[model samples]
Target chain A: MTDESMTNGTMTKSQRIGEIVETSTTGFVAVSKTLHQPPALGSLVKVQLGGEDYAYGVVAFGTTVSPDPGRRAVPRASDEVYDEAVYARQPQLTRVLHTEFSVVLVGCFEDGSIRQHLPPHPPRLHYDVHECTSDEVRRFSERLVYFRLLLDAQGQVPAEQLLAAHIRQVYRARGHDAAWLERAARQVTSLLRDDYDRMMTVLYGIEP
Target chain B: MARKRLGVVTDGAFNAGLTVRLDPGVSTEEMRIGEFVVVEGEGNRYFSLISDMQLRATDAALLADPPREASPFIAQALRGTTTYATVQVKPMLMMPRGADTDFLVDLEPPQPVRTIPMHFAELHEATESDFGAVFGHEDRTHFAMGKPLTMDIPICINLARLVERSNGVFGQSGTGKSFLVRLLLCGVIESGLAVNLVFDMHDEYAFGKESEDGVFVKGLKHLFGSKLLVYSLDEKAQARGGRGVDVTLQIGLNQIEAEDVLLLAEELNLRATAEANVGLLTDAYGADWLSRFLAMSPTDISAFCEQYGAHEGSLSALQRNLKRIERRPYVVPEAPFSVIDEMVAALDKGQHVILHFGRYDHPLDHMLVANVVTRRVRHLYREKVERYEQTQSPADKPRPLMITIEEAHKFLNPAVSRQTIFGVIARELRKYHVTLTVVDQRPSGIDSEVLSQLGTRITGKLTDERDIEAVLTGVSGRSFLRGTLESLDTREQVLLMGHAVPMPIVVQTRKYDEVFYAALGAGEKRSAQLDIVELFGE
Candidate 1:
């Protein structure tokens, strides 16, 4: 899912996740309040940029941690037996722990045309990020060529798993067209006929 | 006028051929094995045959090392990322047009894989005009044989290579070897460039036969009409009911020479002394030897042998071997007229002949007549060729003849190759404007040298590794075509390669129907199409 096609005025205030904290040629780091759930892993997200355009990336990972690891402290009250009860007593833990997610830049979309490459410039710091809407993901998948760029992405991430998850998310985003899935499978088969084992493994992973 | 790019040359050093990687979004189904493709390099178009294909993902090696068990979600995302089709091509020749004229007039020498540039130059699926330009669409050297497996265009082969050298058709039984040979003969005859002498062992070529499916198949005589004549030896009664038989062919015993007798040495099991004695008897009794010599009783033979200074065992063995010939109903002391002479005359006037074996389909009878007749035809063609070379006159030129030998291995086997007339023709008859199309199931049985000499080979499905190896002997890129050869459907799918075709191609052999006959313009309508007298207002 991607919100590249969604308008700025239409996005509800509640959809705001956080601000872009750091950026690089490959991806960006985002910091948000612990309140909102991290966008589903492998889901497309749009980071607001210096320009009017949105920089797109797949949510590779998400985590929450204390602001200062050196100043860590944990105290289990004698009467408290669960983390929920302990968190209810120590409300300041919310202020200490912050949610942050990292995303690999897959492509950029402006005027509803998807460009599967690094954006001309990184999104300006502190810009808000939003989960991609289903409409946006559907619009991006009409050609399915961006799948090439995503597959070609360089990272330590499990490419096969990431690819499968992204496809599953997009497949649902596009109304679960079995025909499209089969066509995609044919392409994969053509490329990997010799590696019968891997083809099978990859194909098995594609099944929902 | 830009043509579509089939693919681009991928990175690989080519010694005899090169591989091309399909571009993004290019489907693998668009091309087929054995179809012709061209590579653009250094301002020239280089032609090649699609030998094989290899398809695999780019990270196949990585995938091999304990792939992370990912769900279908991962598979969907990874689609088309590194997967691609690689087309392995065997380069044949380049068609070079003059830089100034932009017209390709001269044929480039067929030199393969000398220099393959690494520029990843674009390649294109060979068009109909491209195939026509290389294989020819002209009246002199063209005859449509079949259509390309992928395209709707008809395939034509070079007639010069076909008539200038011998050819072979090989396949397992019921693979339509006869149908393929019939189609090939039609092409040869339709061109009016060569005459055919088919030794029809099954009696099918003279008259149509009810196929295994009960469909009546038309023989060559039915298609070519008066141009084709059927000469039956022992099949006179049944062949007469059919329309094609022109002569009740009868071979005189005098026509069987020493060499003719030697062709049946395996069947007759002639010993060295007996075989030598048969020649001696021919020399003494002369041309009438077989009739008079075989008629001699044991008492007369012993007395004659003592007078003629011959060994009893040798003469007796010769007499015993001659007994088989006496039993054949077609053999006579002397026929009213010689069938060999009649055949030579008809061929001289550019008519084709099919010798239907009929009930005489036994190896002995078929070999004897075919051997005797073809030996005479070879001598006749040699003298004509000699005369034409000396006189330099059009009338002295001999009409090219192609002898079609069915069940070719039975006569051109390794043991008989050194002695048989068919073997001699396969070796040296091309110079005399005579060639042979040896059709057989067991290519492994044919002599290796004879097999190599065959200028073209049209092969159907063959499962035997030895037979496949024999068929692919001396064939370039044979390793690459193994799958296509072994996997061909058992019917009309045939892989035609060697000199006749521009490159190796697996064709869905053309159907023999009205459209095919009409394509030949009902046998050379070129001369009748125009008259110079009318142009002169005469």
Candidate 2:
């Protein structure tokens, strides 16, 4: 698919996954349109800020909670009613329990090439988050500098597991580029020098 | 193979040498001690030797708990980054980088390392040109001794510098010390830099002898023919169908001096009083003392001792020791027409002489004969040198002479080095146009003063620490070279150091097989034609 948007400067509606609910320089929280589902953990997602400028992030954490902080949802499913069937039974439950995921700002695509660093500005609130195309994932993973940001990200999910899952996703997106996998592993190894235990943990977690 | 980048200089000192951290791709297993290396600094290139190596890790815990055997990826990633190898390179010499051309290099020779390469200088496996530039190429004055330990390039030694002073060849028995000495003799003969007087104790250098591999290796006589002369001390053995002998060496009893007997005090089991009695006997009987003392009965010795104011017991013991020299077949009361004069005349005419001991290979026999012959030759050389100084005529000048002696410690130990002719030649350098090539297994037994005066020392593997220390006496940067010397291969490898080489190096000695025979035989033919032209005045 073409990286450039139509004349409207917006991604197609089918490609949209969520809208930015809260924004910060380092990260943002996006609420998914589907109930109890945010983008798969560590998957690449992007938000466009008009024209060809876009901000990128890796899905760091996900949770489904009540819309209000004070509100608590009561147990309503029985032995026969669970999973999708229970969700189908309670139509209003989907609206009350919103699914939101946190995204750590990795880099941005501005001017012409992908910059493997934090965006110049935080993406505006309420902007649509889109699932990047296979070509974008291949292009972005080419420069692995952003690996440091993911490794240093502070979140409930351990950094090693988060980076490993993201690499697995990118590996598949890039049609199983084995050479790139080794380069990515070596890059992480160099950054974690002297931290032998942590380096091994990441290396073992990312084994193809 | 192409020259490979091995590592980078990370840490070191001028005295201790530089520490090089291996590059991410280079393997530690491939680095060998005594191998040559070059460090490319900002403006200079330092030629060095790999003296030591160590394996290091970024974290101690990584060594304690290495990656599991099943996980190759963790091991591979940790190899060049977290855990790596470092080699200790002893920088021997340094030269500026722009002196790449041969003409420029000759103009600016490498100097002893006074400073270390800067931190992080690139290190590489030494190339052939590096060996050529440092050790020089084979020519009239330089002889290709051997190749460096890990390279195919020949490492040359300056024959002119080698013959300028006394030299040594040392190693334990069967470590190829004799083979190395033979190669050196061939080089000296081929270069025609100096004439040689070899005391061949085992009869190996004169006539071809069977090697350990059952192959008959050719000797100097076979290669040089008429240009070399073989003198046999055992006429009977020479008569038993062997290579032709030019002369039968016979030492008249009257020719044996008191100094020659005193030099063999230990070999003949003489006491302190023997020295004083020998002096009295020499003062009384002059040059005929050895024969007269041997002819005396116990009563006659007592009468002579009483009249000469010498102890009768010392004189009796001296007579007993004198008997051992008289029993040798070559020793006689008189005749044989001044054999010393003949050998000296041969040496003066630019012919190499090898005095094969034949059956008298015992240390006592070798010691007595070598000392007697060398003393007389040394005296003749001294007179010739004095005559040349007085007359200032080219005809009176003495030709340069190199005396090669095996079991050198017997004549050069602390007790006799001050009086033996070999020790005197060693200390005098080339003053009387005389030098010595001492070959021995127990260099430790050699006097420290004499050992220090050695110009070039080619040593094979030595197991004795004291012998090693003695060989390296008075040498600079000896501690670093000790490791290289100790790491030498047991056969055909030697550590060449001192005046003859620009820097200390370990080399795989050239083989003394048919290939060497071919090289020497060719040189002999050229010299032979020149000799014929000179004789005919064409």
Candidate 3:
């Protein structure tokens, strides 16, 4: 193809991309090749931007449309259908993506194309990292957050996963900075070993 | 005219005597035990009865010259001189019966001694024999006798009369009121004239010295063989193999009318809608409804109400009311229903029923049971009395059902007059041969109206003047015994002042230590011991 034609096509593609981004940010999704539906806020989906795949993004807000028929509209699709596709992909991604993303959903473009958006900045992670000190503390806290989120998503998570994440976080944060790493390590190890103790204590027919 | 010489004895041995010439009007009967007399040669002297007659004369010359200057001839002459004179005697004076008399005598020359009469003083001396004869071994005889039915002091006269006539007891704490009641119970049981039903609050009267065996058990066992029915409202009974006697306790809400239930609900501070719903449920279910109501699952009852288009609030209210009723220990299933029914049945059979409510924690439960039982007995008694008044029968002389409530103030107090069954029994039971024997520490706490109706008053040694005053208001004030009531000590009770006993007399009461000792402290300790045994197997 001629450079001029290629540039024109690229501009058209860029314009289409701009419209998609604008509609997505406005909480709308394209339902068909040419039509759009008003977006439902809190809908989740995946979006591709700058050649990297972002697995989940939530529809944070929906913009009011002008009544004029000439104005191009954005699209919105149901979340139930989107969830099926999302679940079929890497199942572990459900945990990571659910905690990281505000919403997960699917959408169709005007040219019969599909697109996804997964917002990079998860609000919950931001809240946690805001109070973090050293990189080790931040990283450890992130792992702890990840395990907690996983447990929340699954209803019941393995005790080992919780203990491992907890110990790693503590070790990374306090190994060098702590005055007594060996003692702290021993205590943390003992605590991790008795991961199931508290739960058992609560449920072992001991009345509240 | 003649002068008569008379001799008066001073000492029993006649060691010294007085001789005097009588004034003619003096009589021998007029001569007093202690009087002054003078002989012709003797000086003035006092003499008293050694005997009625017999005198050893003293020398008048010795008195005249003070012995130091007396001539031997004059002294001999004074000793031997017995000059005769004309004698005179006065007419005998008459004295009234039961009256005391005093007299004075005077001796002088030429006539018999003159006598003067005076009024006599009355004296009362109580002896140990009197105390020993009335108090008995228990030291609670005065209480048992129910004598001295007065308000001034605690004497056994009123109590004995009260028990004999109306058959009731009253007092205040530390006033030996319970001790009096124990005495009264012994009296009633011993009299063989009437039967007793004791509502023993605090469970004091329930158990004897034998911890495991109690008066309640013994009485029940006597009435119902080895199977003494006991109903416990402890949660431990719900556990497997708990040590509680199994009996059916069906509480009939229908026994009380809707208005009455509402009134009770209002009094209890229950929700209006709940009260209304309970009233409706009770009306629908009738007397046996409580059984079905308790048997129904909570969810089922809720669903049933919903099916009938009842609001959730009303349904919830009904459930709450049921729960409130169920929460009472007495209302728990496996309670002694049959025992109560048997007691009622025994009343119908003209047999006496004694409910020994030994040391129980909830005095109100005793009151409640008293209320229910009294209500039922009163109803039956009314029917019988009415029937008898219409047509007299040999078997129908007021069935003679006596209800003896220990710690009566707890139930029949005017302050918390909740119209319990006991209140009805107290008010109306008397007319139908159902007499109430209200026993309590504080007689002042008992309702005056009920207290007044108790024709017989049994008063024991009451230290509280107020309680004594409360009791004394029920008796006649005309008797001389009223004045002496204050002098009465413990175990010396005034009896039969009320209509029951013909006369007020101090009588000794029989001892029933088994029943009395059981009524001492709160009965909860026994139940606690039983609880420990069941819970810890100790």
lDDT of 2: 0.85
Tens-digit per-residue lDDT, B1-538, candidate 1: 2457877887655654777887755666777767678787765677777777777566656456534775554444343445557887766777553453424446454444466756687777777656665666645566667777767777777877788889999999999888788888888877667889999998767677666667677778887777788888865554456565677788887787777777787788777776667767777788777787888888878887787777887787878987898789988787644567778888876678998887888999888988888888898888999999999999788888999988899789898888888898999857898899999999999998899898999999999998998898888777877767986889888988888886777888888665766765544466333322312334
Of the pair 1 and 2, which is ahead by lDDT? 2
How does residue B518 of candidate 1 score in lDDT? 75
- Total clashing pairs for each candidate: 18, 0, 75
lDDT tens per residue, model 2, B1-538: 3568999999998888999999876897887787888998888889998889999988888888877563676666677778889999988899888844535454478888878878999899888888887999988788998997667878999999999989999998888988898899999988888999999998889888888778889878888887789888888866866587888888888777788888777778889888788888888888888888899988998899679888887778778877988888888798454777988888887888999899889887898888888888899999999999999998777878999998888888997899988888999889999999999999999999999999999999998899989999989877877888788888888999999998888888999998998887787777787766633545
lDDT of candidate 3?
0.39
lDDT of 1 by residue, A40-75 (tens): 777888876544466788877777766575765567
Q: Cα deviation in Å at residue A194, candidate 1?
A: 18
The positional error of residue B457 in candidate 3, measured at the CA in angstroms, is 2.6
Candidate No. with top DockQ: 2
**What DockQ does each prediction reach against the true complex?**
0.12, 0.58, 0.00
For TM-score, the strongest prediction is 2
> How accurate locally is residue A42 in candidate 3, as Cα lDDT from 0 to 100?
26
Q: Write the per-residue lDDT of candidate 3 for residues B9-56, one digit (tens) a residue.
A: 221111222223222223344442211122222221111111122222
Ranking by DockQ: 2, 1, 3
